[model samples]
Structures are given as structure tokens and as C-alpha cells.
Target: DSDSKQKKKKKSKASRSDEDYVQSLNSREDRNKSWWDDFRESVEQAEPEGTGKFLFLKLLLNETCEIGDKVLVFSQSLGVLDLIEEMLKIASERGEGLKSSKGFYRPWRKGRDYYRLDGSISGNKRQNDIDAFNDTKKARLFLISTRAGSLGINLFSANRIVLMDASWNPSFDTQAIFRSYRLGQEKEVYVYRLLAHGTMEQKIYGRQITKQALASRVVDSEETGRLF
Candidate 1:
């Protein structure tokens, strides 16, 4: 009887917690459309645009091209990656065709050559995409999923990294950054972690920093072994 009572109490607590989490998630989604619109406009806007993703685009159009630098763009959500791909595609359609190259096969001639790697991409195809991004000047951007691109890949060619969104765990974001900032990287790497203003993203980014600090403190202390 005592065991049954304890189990029921735990179950009830879990249920209430899940319900509250669902409510919060629902509320966040309600504000999703505006966030996406802002993001799209930022990416699609022409040169000399204002802040946000537009700023990154401005840099890409101005700096990356002028200097022959590459960029790696990371996002945790596959859906977000898809949205970025769509925006890039639209930009391509507006006569932003690939820069002229000799002896290199151009797959899709959408303006601004680019590639995508996520959970949905096949291993062979992913490697192909990476090879293309690394070897060709035409392929200017690599769109990657944070979890998918975090480990076991070296993208030293890209000096610029755009974190389309932040992860709750800062280490994951760190891993994404290192993909470009690692050794063999000749240029000074630039990383941009974008967070939507006045949104849940900002809240999560603040929480991530706090979590990272706590983790560092725990690991650095002599008491860590004893506590564990």
C-alpha cells in the first residue's frame, strides 16, 4: 500500500509538470510566425540591410565574397535549416547564379551556391556536400544542423560561422563553433550566435550561460569527485 501511494504521488507530480511544459511550448509556438518572418526578411533583404540575420547576409555578400571566404551556418532544428535553405533558394532564383568556375560541376545553379547537411541527409551525400563546400569556390555556404554537424567533421575552410540559433547546452553550440574555428584554420574565425529579441530564445540563451558556469564550477572543484 505504501509503495502504491508513493508511485501515485510521483506520477501525479510528473503529470502536472508535463502539463505545464506543454503549455509553455504551446505559448512559444504561438509567437513563431513573426519570428520566422523577421528571419526570412533579414536573409532575403538586399545589401546594406539592418540588424539580425540581415547583418550576416550583408557580411556574406560583402566580406566573404570579396575575400573568397566560406561560411558555415548552424541551426539545431531541422525545420529551421529547411527554412534557411528555402530562403537561399529564393535568393538564387533572383539571378544570383553561381559564380563562374572551370571544370567544377555545379549541381543546382541557384544564385549563391550552397549545400545542406542534417539528420535527413545520407552519409555519402553528406560527405559529397562537405567535399563540394571545401573544394569549390562556387559553393559559398554550408547549412548544417547543430547536432548533426557537432562532431567527426572538420570544416576549416569556412572562417565565418553563423549560429542560427543557440542550444540549451552551450557545449553543443561550442562544438558547432569549433568546426570552423579549429586548427588548420588560417584566418581569424568569426562566430555569430543569433537570438530573437524579446523571445524565449533570449531566455534560453541566458539559462545556457548559467548552466555552463555551474558545470564549469562543478568540474573544476576538488569536491566534484567526492560529490559524485
Candidate 2:
């Protein structure tokens, strides 16, 4: 009985020592990790399935493309446009087909199926892309920078306008929507404004609504006074 008790005590000590060694190794590894490693891990965990905004945008694109509708996606930031372009390219490489209503729809190809316009592009190239988008059946998506695309641009070819983010000034968003809702548009126009529920975007959009309401009231008051 004494020998058995001694053996049991030794086994218990060995088990505790093994557990302590594992905990020490884990602590050492954590100490060895740099800030960049921690940051990357956090980002990967946060965006395990890409961003919610981008995922919804992809679903919207799939539906619109399947029905043979062209889309104009506008973003206030050039960086956002760049990220979208990269996403589209990656989707194209994965053989993600848009499956248009037309019997012979092909897989989406950048430069052929989609176009981009921004301040960085030369005026000639911008006009050329616009023309291609307007004239070609294959061109189904156009990604535009809001500041650069809001002025003197006509995109009657696309009936769907996607506002990827809100603008501080409501007129910028209005102009972006009207790009596709012009005189020559044959189909019904649809506008989609994507905003994260608890973000600055919702605040900006609320402000935009208030500003528009105030402007309308001022105009109505002016008209009422003028009639008398």
C-alpha cells in the first residue's frame, strides 16, 4: 500500500509538470510574437469571409448580371474602387460567371466586361471606356470615383446605380444616381445605397436627409411668398 501511494504521487507530479511546461511554451510563443503578427491575426479573424459590404455587393452584382442589367457602382474613395477592382478580378479568375439572360453570356472579364473611370485616367482613355461601356453588350459593370464621375458624364447604358458609400454632400450622391437615370435610358432605374448600421455612413445619410428637407422647405416658402 505504501509503494502504491508513492507511485501515484509521482504520476500526479509528472502530469502537473507536463501541464506547466506546455503553459510556459505558450507564454514564450506569445512573447515572441510581434505587433504585425498580432494585427494580421486579428484582421484575419475579423474578416473570415470577407467584409459584409463586399459580400452584399457581390450578391447584388450576381442578381443584376444574371438578368442582363448593367450596373454603375460609385464610391467616394478611390481606395474603395481599387479594392472592388481587385475583388472583381479575383472573381473572374475563379470562373464566376454572371450568367446573363442572353443565351451566350460569357464569364466576366476585366476591361471587357467591366470598366473603371477615375481622375488618374487620361481624358481620352476615360471617354474611350465610356464609349465602350455604352456601345458594347459585354460591358455590364462600371466602377466610378464619385468626385470624378459626377460631372459631365452620361451613363444611360446602366440602369442600376450602386452607392457603395455615402457622401457628405447629398448633391454628389444625387448626381451619381442621375448618371444612369438620363434621357436615353430604356429600362427602369434602381438605386441602392449600402450603409453599415452603426457607422459614420448612417450619420452622414441622416444629415443628407435633413439638409434636403430644409432645402425643400425653404424653396416652398419662397414660392408661397412669391405667389402673394
Candidate that would win on TM-score = 2
lDDT of 2 by residue, 72-106 (tens): 99987665676677677666566665556653335
Cα lDDT over the full model 1: 0.67
lDDT of 2 at 17: 18
Model 2 TM = 0.74
Distance from true location, Cα of 179 in model 2, Å:
0.3
- Tell me the spans in candidate 1 whose CA falls farther than 4 Å from its real position: 1-51, 96-112, 219-228
5 in model 2: Cα distance from truth in Å?
93
Model 1, 1-228: lDDT tens digits are 999999998677546412332333444465465555666565344432344564566446445655677888888766555555555554456654333333222233433377777655667877777877887777677878777778778888899898888888889899888998888888999987787788888888888877776787887863322211
For model 1, give the 10-residue run with minimal summed lDDT: 97-106
